[model samples]
Target: MKTLLLALLLLPIAAIGDDSRQLVKLPPAAQESLRQEMLDNLVAVNEVLTLMAEGKVKEAGEAAETKLGMAAMGKHRGKPVDARPGPHMPPAMHGIGMDGHRAVSEFAAVAKTGDRDKALALLPNLTSACVGCHFSYRTR
Candidate 1:
């Protein structure tokens, strides 16, 4: 009985981190597009990390800048959310997106300077922004 009660109490906590299509409530096409964008971003991040691992710091930084920086926003503009028939993102969600890009841009700048230690340290903070957003928002 004690263990069962404990499990029940922790259930919502577990679900909090597993939020899915419940928060954003977008159309199917828009949701899929968003998911695809997320996958693409993940791929870009992986490529940047690979380059960094190979000691190609400049190239890695360039990759991060091109893939996740301000330049990348142009490609996403009017495509992911604006031109697509969907509701506007809540301000909190919008802020999360901007914050994430800023973190990546800062990381790219650090990597560009060949400061491996500082760049690596920043990666965790960038990742934390991603995880926090995931935990706090979801799209259907």
Candidate 2:
């Protein structure tokens, strides 16, 4: 009885772990578009990181703002391509969309006020969202 109870308890944890793993099933065109968007964001984020490391906070903030804006607009194709119904859309993609919007909004607020310190502080959250998205959904 104890062993069975323990197995039952662990089963939910295992299921939750599986739930967090994303398996994206994007069409070829959608895959290409997402790849391009990731590349663009990577470049922009890299530039901002470089600038920030050099203590060019203002320039970094500006670049960050641009990157964030691009993310917000989903500039690759201006929106998520319509995926076929069912498990076509991964959980990570949904997480990315939500987190990306939050990160971008935070960066925008800091950029508008020219708050370099705040912007710099907020950079990690933005980068986290990007990294999180990439880890889950990348074209093979």
lDDT of each: 0.67, 0.59
Clashes of 2: 0
Candidate 2 displacement at residue 133 in angstroms: 2.6
My TM-score estimates for the predictions, one after another, are: 0.75, 0.63
For candidate 1, the lDDT comes to 0.67
Q: State which candidate has the highest TM-score.
A: 1
lDDT of 1 by residue, 1-140 (tens): 23223333444664655443236776676667677778888998789879978988878778888888655664545675543422466765666666667767888898889888888887653454466566556663
Clashing pairs in 1: 24-138
